[model samples]
Target chain A: MAAEVEVVKNKQVLLKDYVTGFPKESDVIISTENTISLKVPENSSGVLVKNLYLSCDPFMRGLMRKPAPNSRTPLPAYKPASPIYGFVVAKVVDSSHPKFKKDDLVWGLAGWEEYSLITETDLLFKIEHTDVPLSYYTGILGLAGITAYGGFYEVCNPKKGEKVFVSAASGAVGQLVGQFAKLTGCYVVGSAGSKEKVDLLKNKFGFDGAFNYKEEHDLDAALKRHFPQGIDIYFENVGGKMLDAVLLNMNMFGRIAVCGMISQYNLDEPEGVKNLMWLIHKRINMRGYSAAEYYPHYTKFLDLVLPHIREKKITYVEDIAEGLESVPAALAGLFSGRNVGKQVIVVARE
Target chain B: MAAEVEVVKNKQVLLKDYVTGFPKESDVIISTENTISLKVPENSSGVLVKNLYLSCDPFMRGLMRKPAPNSRTPLPAYKPASPIYGFVVAKVVDSSHPKFKKDDLVWGLAGWEEYSLITETDLLFKIEHTDVPLSYYTGILGLAGITAYGGFYEVCNPKKGEKVFVSAASGAVGQLVGQFAKLTGCYVVGSAGSKEKVDLLKNKFGFDGAFNYKEEHDLDAALKRHFPQGIDIYFENVGGKMLDAVLLNMNMFGRIAVCGMISQYNLDEPEGVKNLMWLIHKRINMRGYSAAEYYPHYTKFLDLVLPHIREKKITYVEDIAEGLESVPAALAGLFSGRNVGKQVIVVARE
Candidate 1:
């Protein structure tokens, strides 16, 4: 006996076309014409999910562009008139896959629409710990969390008493990296775009020092002032002039873990970095990494960070936008620094 | 009774003043005004050596400049009116230091003069194997040898069948790095400034592909032509635009070991690198290192390379400058890409 299929309106934020420079709200369209089935089709290996949360990450800017020929970008590009997708927290409505089932809480690659039929279950993760806010699954407990773990703990390999500096502090991963550095017993300083964010970095993230980068005319002088003894580790989020300044103040054998270069993502021509020669003079090690590469460490990362979150040893801040329709403004706001901490959009509460 | 101290005329290449940019022969003065004895002074643990071979290395340009305030450059600056010094192959004439003795051959840091009283014998290494040409000590057995060994083997960590690229490919360290990549079972390409050096890279260094970077309008396109699969490892001897181009053509998880940035050394304001954002996309690991730091691996490096030299499996080219008088021109010529190979100034044959 066959059962009647349940269909519902699936509101989405669709990409109009590939972005050239800075993305705008006009680049995305709010569409409600699509209807999605709540059931996974018979004999099909797919999971039907109700999107609960969608992340507004800086890396999304890359996905909005048409990839160059022979480009090796690990993430897939968005297709025109299709719902843009990224790391998301969703509730499984139904599943034909063995790993996921109905009512299962999960977080991973999903669409920005109200409902998504995820075909690749490999990118999905079944959420285990739900005591702390489920909204965290969109950020600190998801890709952003493991990114800080891999880039800082694995790449930078910070040691106790080492001096650490983080640019774009108070943002999703930067905020986490600062907290991680503090937990590692390193003296850490962070630079943010706003005084309010700087305050959050020092007060909320427990950074040893914090500064508003917008007020400083000389980035190099700013770094020198905060890092008088020279920085031993740099968690690079913003690139360009800030990266150049950090290079000048880097200690010998210092490490720079480049998780993102948000500053150059929108430029027609990315800004040139002038101080890379210092890498040789100071024997610095600088590496770039994506958090998805560290998914294998999710369980281990959870074991370490979950307890810290509960014990108040570490904390996370998120700026959430209500409803799926808000994604156009929310995603565009990321480049303009309109949101604080992790920028996330809510499609549903549960 | 003290033994007779036989004083002799000591010719030196002295720095007239700290250079501002693009060193000219006039910046360095040839002076024969000094005289030195063949014996170490009383109560001093110094070693006196008659310079046989003086290495004309690119790093010397950094020392010729007045170092920036609070700069973390590991190399010391050359004082005005003082004889500049660098790695040299010499015969120990006399020594009060326990490690060195009269007539024993050595290679290490020494003055750019006929005879030098070297107080820092710690930097010196006794010449153990004399079967190879003594001139080889100025290059293949000295800092240039280890610079290539460390930057390629220790830093780049090349895997078999990987693609490798060397910038400034016909220079001292770059020549060796290309050969080392070939020895490691890697496909190697080299970029030089002139057609003659490009021929040397292919014919002498056994590079799979050689291109005159000066002839290429777009370095990125040139790299793409040579490295269709993209570069897995880069031995970065020349920074600036070369580094930027290499970044564009790097494969995922590529490693770049920057031993020197010869192109940027003489610039008042070093050229800006525009493609650093690719570092993030490609997940590249770029590190800088000085061969001196890898002195501990000198013996292991020798054991591996000596046999290759003996079996003619590897070869070295030397651009021999005839006398101390030729140094002013030789040192300045390095900036203008005048030297075809490892430049060595011969003060004495034996």
Candidate 2:
């Protein structure tokens, strides 16, 4: 005995084609030809959501490239002229799943559109805390937070007084990791592409030291100057030459938690890691991890971080591009280092 | 009172010069000019030992090269006309240390000479349980064994039914790793340079499968064929191209225990690992370890491996060259894949 649901226009940012190199705003088209019902279909098990915020991450660039022949990750290719998918914060408008209900706010993977039919409800986590800004779920309170937590604590096993280094320091995960390192009483240094981000890392994020990598001609000398002894933990966000330099400066028994290799994503071929021999020479441990595998620890992470957020012990910086039409430009800006902190698109605010 | 021990001529293998590129037999010179006293110097905490077996490992090649300006490990440059140093099995002729006594059979770092005055007796481990072949101290029951045990069990954290892959399968560490993988109830594949080694890996070492990497035109294709479901554990003994290929074939959450990079040891410029990006894509854990770090686990490793050795569940192969005169050729042969198994120089027979 339910009333027939209203149908509405669904505006989406669609990929014009699979990108070759660095992506441009012109490569995506904002389309409003599609429509979606406001209610779940008869006998359907999916939840219908109104997308609010979408994340613009550097990893998204890798998705735009044609997958390698032997690529193990079988992430679905973006169909020409179809809406692409990424991490999204949404409101459940209609639901047939037992775990989710109407009007519940949740965060997980969804399409780059105003409305989405999420067939896979398992990945979606219902947002319980409403005191914080809802858009925080797009970055600091969601995947990026989990990534920083797991990569720094679990993978690196960081210790107090350890020398920690982070690349792409003002990005979503990097900014959080620097703060976490400080909380653990570790001496941390961060490298960013610009002076403003470097200043933000030192002044706002509370990192012990910060540097503009673009200004340093010799990364090895720069690292040597910053870490005279050597780096104990390296949160590797940018790969290629940065990784090569980090390898040379790593201390014995050092740990490198590989989160995302943003520098290598847009390249036709990844830059070779030349000094990997140091891995053997110094007895270093380098591990690569994805936030998806850490979903089980999400509640634990929330408990640890939420109190810090509420007490003002921790802070998150966001760079938001308003509306669905700005999605392409926001995503493209990630590669150019335009966004200062977490790049988010405010698709449709509740 | 002990009589003043007489000095005797010590036949030695001397380095002609700090080597560049692949080493040659002429790179080392046989010198009989050196002499050693049979007694430890009065009040000196040292052990005087007669060398019996000298181990020629791939790491020695790195020692021949001039150290890089920023090299972390400052191994002393091999002085011309002076005997080089490596792992050696020797009988203590005289001892001033409480832990070591006269006539104790021990193995540790020593000069490539007939007799050595070991100032640092701490590294020497007294050979207990002499029921096994004394020469076994050079390879199977020594550093090679410890490397395999710690790298596979501690570093790799191998699980039953996992798919394991090993490079340089016929060499000292790789041979042991393959056997240990089998003991763990894992599916194991190995790559060697020659067909004889390949056959030995399958028939003698009981590997599930093995291939001659030299014969295989495409290493990735070969790995794909052997590890159709992808590799869960990679015992990385040979780095460079093999490492690159293994990265492509690694399964999600795969562990790579890097024991050595024998292939890149002689190169002026080490080959770049191009597919390291797959490390992030697959959530792989690659760790580099050395036997030196696992000294604390020596007893535990012996407890696990000794039973297998006594029960004939495990076996070792040694390609031995007789006398100090043959040491140079034996060491040089390692680069050309001339040695079938563990390359040992039989300085003297007990």
Candidate 3:
């Protein structure tokens, strides 16, 4: 009865089973009954982290299902009795790894539980800038930030004064891409699921123009009307019909940087693209990219982006959900366009 | 006694009307009535040429039809009552231009006639190295050759030890791309419509592997069988089903150079690609290019390829039709894959 108080317990959300169709909140259950020793064992290269914030992304929905047998992605099924892991910002309670230390802040792959023990030290990044919101490490200052940067600059190779179009422009990555394009002297336009998101892209993220894709009956015609000169660069976040429409309105030598295809992920089979033949006529360049492959440029990107954040030259918004129990609703919110900006789950206070 | 004259009249194949469906020999009528007095008017910027050879490419079929009102390409129906113009190897009978003179052999846009009066002098290239066959100028040493070189080297950006797949592998452009990939140390494989072309690619063109696409029931499986590592570069010539399959088998960071879509040109509506979603998953880069766009590099390309031709280091094959009257059948041969190598008509004796 050392303190005569409640033991600090870890809580997590577990997948009850593989999901089909739209995921329901009951597909996952929040449980709190675990504890990790706040000490690193001798000769062990492990770091015990108390997670502070977590990211909720659309791709997480893909991981809810048992991966197809011959799939190339490392999205294995979440064991029924275990916690799910994703990008998280945490405080290292104890560590034996030389690169990290006790009481240091870090961000990497962490479990939904309050505490996670990381064995592989290579994946973790020590947080250097504390002036910005720590929760940002889960979204804008983390994987999503680097993804929007690398996919737009390295993959799309955007030229100044070019016309840029982004799908899912109000989402985490899309919002950043639209802002980046605007900063780069491009005429940036975006498409969102609803009128509210469209307004956010224009007024909040400062996109040059925006449209509600749902209201447009003919996507190709809408694109033609908006981008009369044709799009020079397309940051593809939502695929399917949007991609098909983009193909029809691409200018000669246009570049498409494919980051994600959230629209087609839940479908039983992906939709067919009808305007692919336009690829030949317009002489477009479409390239896909993953952020994990571009980690070498992380420091360079941080140097470039962090100063902008401090100067208030770059602005970010977040939809924060409190407690680990709120993770289910936060994740489900991504598909319905409920998140206003970067979606995050705050687990605990500093 | 009258001069021993052969009547030396210009013979032309005039388009009777804009064609529909499959073109026939009756669509074009060969007549020997037109002659320009075999003279270049004083101060006129024209080169009177004795056409030696004419190229028959699938693009010519498009010229046979009326272009849609809003088409980006200027390709339109051949002037209703005029002779068709295309790539040709010709001897200048007379020239008002400074760079060319009588007896100067040149290759460029010329009428599908025994003799043509070319007004655009800048489009013509004076034959410098004719050590190889003259017909090679119409295929390997001409626009087709430049298309293969620029599209693969500039667009695809080949890396050594990369896996490269080319479609229509035994055609004028495909054979050269395979050879170029081989020279760059890429593991090159190609697909052809027939077994004979497959053998030609492996035995004659030094491709790493070859296959007849027409015989493969499952193109995705075929790609996996040949390229277990997946294709790093795809030189897309045929479109439709092959594109859908290749999308599934492209590696992360793969590049696709869309030079032509021979398969879809004759169709009333272009075939839809079903697996385009794979473009985002693998981070593939697909681009289309035209040889016309590489005009600035033509001199540099000629310097590189002409020497290869002179050394016999690069081999080119041509299927020759004996007269101007054979133009329509030769052009139609492109659609059915009936001609081996480049289908060319010998409009006049070289």
All candidates' lDDT scores?
A: 0.90, 0.90, 0.85
- Ten residues in sequence with the least summed lDDT for candidate 2 chain B: B68-77
The DockQ value obtained for model 3 is 0.58
lDDT of residue A19 for candidate 3: 76
Superior by TM-score: candidate 2 or candidate 3: 2
* TM-scores for every candidate against the unseen true structure: 0.98, 0.98, 0.92
Candidate number achieving the greatest DockQ relative to the actual structure:
1
Write one digit per residue (lDDT tens) for candidate 2, span B60-130. 88888877776658356677878899889999999988999999999998999999999976578999979
Encode model 3's per-residue lDDT on B140-228: one tens digit a residue: 88888989999998999999999999999899899999988987899999999898899899988889999999899999899999999
Model 1 C-alpha lDDT per residue in residues B1-350, reported as the tens digit of each score: 86777999999989999998899999999998999888888888889999999999888898998877866566689999999999899998988988888999999999899999999877899999998989888888888899899889999888999999999989888888999999889999999999999999998889999999889999999999999889899999889888888998899999999888888888888888989888888899999888878899888989988999999998999999999999989999989999999999999987
Model 1 misses residue B151 by how many Å? 0.9
Cα RMSD of predicted structure 2: 1.5
lDDT of 3 by residue, A235-327 (tens): 999888899889988998798888888888777777766676677677777777788767788899898889988988778888899998887
Candidate 3: list runs displaced more than 4 Å: A1-8, A33-35, A41-43, A74-81, B1-10, B15-37, B41-44, B74-81
Worst-scoring 10-residue span by lDDT in model 2 chain A: A66-75
